[model samples]
Target: MTTTPRRYHITTFGCQMNKADSERMAGILDNMGLISSDDPNEANIILYNTCTIRDNAEQKVYSYLGRQAKRKHQQPDLTLIVAGCVAQQEGEALLRRVPELDLVMGPQHANRLQDLLEQVFNGNQVVATEPIHIVEDITKPRRDSKVTAWVNIIYGCNEHCTYCVVPGVRGREQSRYPEAIRAEMEELGRQSYPEITLLGQNIDAYGRDLPGVTAEGRNKHTFTDLLYYVHDVPGVERIRFATSH
Candidate 1:
């Protein structure tokens, strides 16, 4: 007897950060031998990479989850996941709201997709919202663009602006090592992706959390310094960045 091949569909909502996170998770799934599916209803695993920056976005996640949750009743073997900001914010409450979910994981836990899914496969419902120092990305992203790519130079934010939910859900500022950032860019350059966007919740705040200082008492890894650092990577034609702050 032959077993059915695993298939997955991911629906992403919100910012470039969320989009980047989705691509990474897709890479993780791909590495696990799951084929990508365009239709959520046809896939064995369905993921909603969520956003909660606005009330409407948050509400939309629940609506999407409702439909999938209903489908889960008939397809008892289907795996359901809610990821990104809403997962971070709602935590176990999401499981309470949607008991059919197999995994509820945060933006910080994006790189741990495989491990969490392992727990799910073991007949466990997992919630992984606790803050962690982000693992250095080693998984290749299933990027949507052939010519452009997103390189995350930093994760999360430090600001507490009353108008934003980013800091609360994404956790504290965690800068990727500048060396790691450049290594990713170098690989993208090798892949012939001419345009690369550096992503951050607060782009200007890059490298402030790193442990380094210049002899002149200046930050050794400031965003300006980073720009100068990776400016001449081979095959990269253009670079851009996003800032929520």
Candidate 2:
């Protein structure tokens, strides 16, 4: 007997970081041979790459989860995942609120999508919210734009601004090695993506956590230095970045 092919739908909510995370996760799914599906109801796996920056966005994730949780009763084979900031913030409470969820993973775990789903396939409900030294991204993102792409130079934020929930949910600042950043851009350049956006929760805070210092006591890997490092990538005509402190 033949088994039905698996399909996935990823609904992303909030920020360039979350969108970037969604693209990476989608790439992982594609690598695992899952086809993309437009309709959440028709997909065998439904993933919500969420944001908890605002109260409304957090509430919105629960609303969507409720509908999918109900559907899981009848579709026992369906896999439901809550990933990104809200999942990081809520943790196991999300599982308590929606027991049908197969995986509750944080933004930091986006690169581990395949491993997490393997546990789910084995009939296990998994929660992976603990902080970690983020793995260097090797997955090829399914970029939403043919002309533009997002390259994450950094992950998380160090600031604990009273008004923002970013630091609490995204954990501390972790910068990707400059070599990896340029390599991703180089690949994007070869793919004919002319414009690339370097993404981060706090774009201005790019290389503080990384170890390195210039002879002049300046950070060797500051965002300014990074800009210069990847400036000459072949085929990429323009570069942009996100929110600043």
Query: Model 1, 1-245: lDDT tens per residue?
Result: 98777999999999999999999999999999999999998998999999998789889889989998999999999999999999999999999989999999999999999999999999999999999999899899999999999999999988889888889999999999878999999999999999999999999999889997999998878999999999999999999999846
TM-score of 1: 0.98
Pairs that collide in candidate 1 are none
Off by over 4 Å in 2: none
State the displacement of the C-alpha of residue 166, model 1, in Å, after optimal TM-score superposition: 0.7
Mark the regions of model 1 whose C-alpha exceeds 4 Å error after superposition: none
Residues 45-117 of candidate 2 have per-residue lDDT tens digits of 9999998877788889899999999998999999999999899989999999999999999998999999999
Lowest summed lDDT window (length 10), candidate 2: 51-60
**Candidate 1 RMSD computed on C-alpha atoms after optimal superposition onto the true structure:** 0.9
lDDT of each: 0.93, 0.92
- How many Å off is the CA of 178 in candidate 1? 1.5
